[model samples]
Target: MTNSKKFALVTGSSNGIGRAIAENCAARGFNVLLVALPEPKLEEVTNALAAKYPNQEFHCLGVNLMDAGAPQEVFQWCQKNNFVVDILANNAGLGNSGDFLSKKAEFYFGQMQLNMVAMVMLTHHFLPEMQKLDKAYILNVASMASYYDIPFKGIYAASKKFVSSFSHSLRYELKDSNVFVSILCPAAVLTNPEVIKRDANMGFVSKITRQTAEQVAEYALSRMFNRKPVSIPGVFPKFYRTLGRVIPHRMQLRMLANAFIKQSRE
Candidate 1:
């Protein structure tokens, strides 16, 4: 790790909440390491951010995290570039809504690989270095669905639950270290076109709980730096998660079935 300026490494930073977070970090005077798949989107975002923040250094890493070796490769790339990481944001994840049984076995496996395994691997690779620093931050992006088991989005919810649980436990484990870990569980972030349309169709719930990607990104970084264990971005999302805790499991499952199954039919 270089002794020069601090760098914040953000995964899935090509667009959406990840991109916003990266931009926020750069705006706060940290050099940004942008990681995403090898695509034009990555180049476009890196170029735009570099132009926007000409004072802060922006390094682009185009690697697919779905590949098992990608995390190590990213670590090595940073080492080679003499970029010392002061913050790590494990924000790369995917979510799908559908009957689990209807999808191929490989589809579910791939989600596990990307949504869970990749996150763990990235944290594992960067944490030791972060621990060596006087102060460092790790923000793992979970989801509001982590608090409930949704019928149609079973795997997605379960994966996020693992992330939420793992992040909290890891925070305690690293309490004595300089590394501070936090998790962000945002509800409906209007990240893509599909989500934008879905949010409009979901009636009042979406409007109440839903937040824009930029809003979530800004809120998440603030909470993470403050060392908050868990962050639910919007007021309604925080309320919804709090309410989910006391509800009976059977009732929660029933409500999810009624809501999501009805949406599927519609």
Candidate 2:
């Protein structure tokens, strides 16, 4: 990594929205440090991005963020390599749709570890170094589900709500600092085959609010740089979020529960 070039450390960046964010960062002149699970895909993405943006540096670290102490390990690796991370994108997360009881206890534990705990740990480990810079940014990838209590995606929604709340609080605390914190609460993103199929099966609302991974990444980075506290990528998602605010919480819960229950059965 070049000492003069800024770096964006992006988690879960081997595929999906994470990958798009890494690519977008490179396009915007930031060297990228891509973190994901140990897989050939990670190396492939690293090489591809390096070739595409020859002027920028692209590095990959494959480690499971859900494991204890993993965030510290990542920070140490960056320190060892002298990779100054100007932007921290805590984008790694896990989500599954099913009846809460249908999944094993281990599944929920791992989901929380990755979606909530890992995000917090990574931010904690990185924030001090980020604050030392003239300007830095932390982008937490939450979900539009953070705004509602849905039936089938209860755990995922709750985890994202934690992200939303944590990001807002942290951003407020750092209002006078160089560290700018933002959260991306995208609605339905068409990320992969499974996600595409799942979104196709959902209601009209999901379809209308759906965005491509690239679209979400573009919007998220723009908003993050602009210091926008919360970024919802699509027009329909913004509208839906506004509408949700006016509806009573009990009615919103019932409507979401009914819709998700029917969708799950189908």
lDDT of each: 0.87, 0.90
| Per-prediction CA RMSD (Å) | 1.5, 1.7
Error of 2 at 189 (Å): 0.9
Estimate, for each residue in 174-229, the C-alpha lDDT of model 1 and write its tens digit.
99889999999998888987567667767788888888888898898998888888
lDDT of 2 at 116: 94
Task: Judge candidate 1 at residue 68 and give its lDDT.
Answer: 82
Judged by lDDT against the true structure, how good is candidate 2? 0.90
* Candidate no. 1 TM-score: 0.95
lDDT, candidate 2, 1-266, per-residue tens? 34545689999999999999999998998999999999999999999999999988999999998898888899999888898889999999987777888889998998999999989998998898888899999999999899998888899999999999999999999999999999999888888675776677775878898898999999999989998999999899999999999999999988888767755665
The top-ranked prediction according to lDDT is: 2
Candidate 1: residue pairs that collide:
none
What's the lDDT of the predicted structure labeled candidate 1? 0.87
